[model samples]
Target chain A: MLYALMIYAEPGLDERIPQEEREGVTAEYQALLDDPRVVQAARLHPAEAATCVRVVDGRTLVSDGPFADTKEILGGLALFEADDLDEALEMAARIPAARMGGAVEVRPVVVQP
Target chain B: MLASLVGYLRDFDAAEEATQEAFTIAAERWETSGIPANPGAWLVTTARNRAIDRIRRDRTLTRKIPLLPEPEATMDEFDDPVIDTVIDHLGDTGIKDERLELIFTCCHPALPLEGQVALTLRALGGLSTADIARAFLVSEETMKRRLTRAKAKIKATGIPFAVPQADRLEQRLDAVLAVVYLIYNEGYRGRVDLGAEAIRLGQLLAVLMPEEPESRGLLALMLLHHARRRARFDGEDLVLLGDQDRTLWDLPQLEAGRAALEEAIARGGRGAYVVQAAIADLQTRDEIDWPQVAALYRRLVELTGSPVVELNRAAAVAETGDPAAALEVVDSLDLDGYLYYHSTRGELLRRLGRDDEAAAAYRRALDLATTTPERRFLTGRLEKL
Candidate 1:
């Protein structure tokens, strides 16, 4: 089963991260992608740039910004194909995105019949 | 030795900088001279001599005379003739700092009780913010803020480093004892570098209030409790008091406890710590001193009027004579938020052969436990019952 792992990064971490440190983090992300079970992964821009897209009765509506504003923001996400939630969560935990004051939210993805 | 020595002679910030500078110099020079026989002693002597050189070269002391308090009698400044004196002064005993004055300063009751204990642990106990947070069972951010507020209050109030005066000292005695007791407890836990820090705190308080009953009581409490620490746990987990090996108890610590108890007895007025220590001493005795332990508990009840004291008294009272009497006392206590009281009361019930009631109490304790270890331990006891 594939799980969508959401990365929550503490505020202003991107600006604080040096170029060299950023490259190291990117390399870590690349290593995760190399694992065949990782079907999809992307480091999102700051939540402010996000446009929430939802489809109701085949009518798609786009919102101006992200879902919430808090002390932290949803910075990135990944999709992992694993046999169980625990296995998916293990992969999510090792993701560089989840380290350095970030938490990963693991949600199992459902496929349409 | 140099880092610690500099840290002592000068203030924290300056001493740290001087140590760094000395290390940098040593690193550069060592390629030629090779390593010294004793790196620490050589570093200390070099740092001191270097510090003196800088001081004489600066020639700024005369200018700052109005601002800087006159320094301590400079006991033989480091020169070829005075090297022996300097080394003696810098020896382990001289600079151990004891942290006595600092503990008293931090534990002043002008700060709230929580602040007094927390600040003393932070400043003198050498506890990190996260470590304090864990010990207090509070969030790290909350602990950081509390520490910051306490430090700001110190800076704003300009609280003198010297111990408080006569009337206030007597007024604040309880607070001091509480801080010392907490330090001792942390040391007894054996995690955290509390040995040097907390022992130093205890030794400091014991010296500061040589005649105070509770102070001696606090020392006796620590020595007695620490005596069992080696035997308290088996491998990673609590061995439970009934299961602990009596042979492993430290005879030296027990002797020290007896000496402290004598001092506390000689001094007369007592508090809860004295009572607790007396009970622990009784428990460790070859023959239980039931009557004395019960009397101390009764005195503690009079001092604090706390139901917790009544609960403890119940245990000693039962051990002395009637389990029935002890059960009644334990049954009367209303410790709604406390988990241990219920568990303890249950154990007392079991000893008196009230199996069903003991099982119920164990269940209640299991439900109330906050940690996985405590929950597991209580549940295991409940299952067996």
Candidate 2:
């Protein structure tokens, strides 16, 4: 099964980390992406830089920030190929953001044949 | 049969619908043709076929086509040789493993606790949705939605239909045992015969995981409680264990319970369930050992770190000819809102000849009591004071 591990974190959460621990945190995330099960991974730009776009009737509606105003914002995402949700969850739990005042949503990806 | 179907289909809702369809067909055809020699295998084969047909027709389930077993060359109805071949393919042991897998999947910790309980009862206990709803004091529609949402989450989250690996097995098994115990407690409170259903599930677990002594312990614990079910009450009034009629107890069931507890002990099991079973077994002895019971309660308090267990320990301490110390221990704990705490306090105070305080404590217990018999007992205590 394919799962999308969407990492949600408070804005500027990385900034709060001690300078000495920053490299270790980065290394942890790097280790996660290095896993063979990780099909694709990407760290997103801060939610503030995100542009939301929607086509309404005949006009296009654009927003300056994320689509939802929430305390936690989408920080990163990884697509994983795992046997089941439990395996995907194990990877999700390893995401540094998950233990650092953030959450990882383990969503099963829809398979298309 | 449903378990095997779920194993083959890998979709709970699809398997349930297919099983239902197969049973309906069997009910109509069995009357004229008489029952099949192997009714269970027949139902499983029919359900697998129905599920495969439904999945084939549904375009969105195209990805699941690969998971289905190879179809028979000819999909003829009631082909005895084909059924025999399929049954042979799924040996008897395979069916048993499938049921175990189904149980582990149903009671997975990833699911909500209520979902675990509901799904276990529905799938393993073979309770209808309506019956489960009634037992849980919910409307049929609410129960339906709960089951639907749970099943959907199981599919969407890709919860595997297999026993957890050794690393995760202990924690997962604890969740399963807790759900069964919760069902038994619900029935113990006089909801329905969910206690019987839980015992059946416990028996299945003990058989499936013979090496796991906790399974035997849980089976023992439930059987011990169930053996005393008839002696638990006299008409509508709650009969205290000491006052319960000995003849009303199921002696054979108690023996079975004791034997299960012995097996658990022989396996060197001292987990929460096993300890609890030992405590229960001690309680049923001809001569009660208050000091030993208190020691077990103390151990249980350490193991559970629960205030409720501490309260029980206090009760046992009182039985050891130290009501004053027991009362002091009860007062130290923050259980003012608990009915049993007040009742225990009242009893201790009455023993210490503090009638006025005991009456006040009884009033508090009376206010907190929810059951008729409990209220009556509290009132009687107050009257005596």
The CAPRI classification for model 2 reads as: acceptable
DockQ of each: 0.01, 0.42
Writing each residue's lDDT as its tens digit, candidate 2 over B162-188 gives: 888777777788889987887787677
Q: Give the DockQ of candidate 2.
A: 0.42
How much does candidate 2 score in TM-score?
A: 0.62
DockQ of 1: 0.01
Compose the digit string of candidate 1's lDDT tens values, residues B142-248.
Answer: 77767666655544344445556664566666777778778767776654346445555566677777767887787787778777887876654556766889888
lDDT of 1 at A94: 86
Best by lDDT: 2
Chain A TM-score relative to the true structure, per candidate: 0.78, 0.97
Model 2 agreement with the true structure over A31-99: per-residue lDDT tens digits: 888999999999999987999999999899998999889999999899999998778877788899999
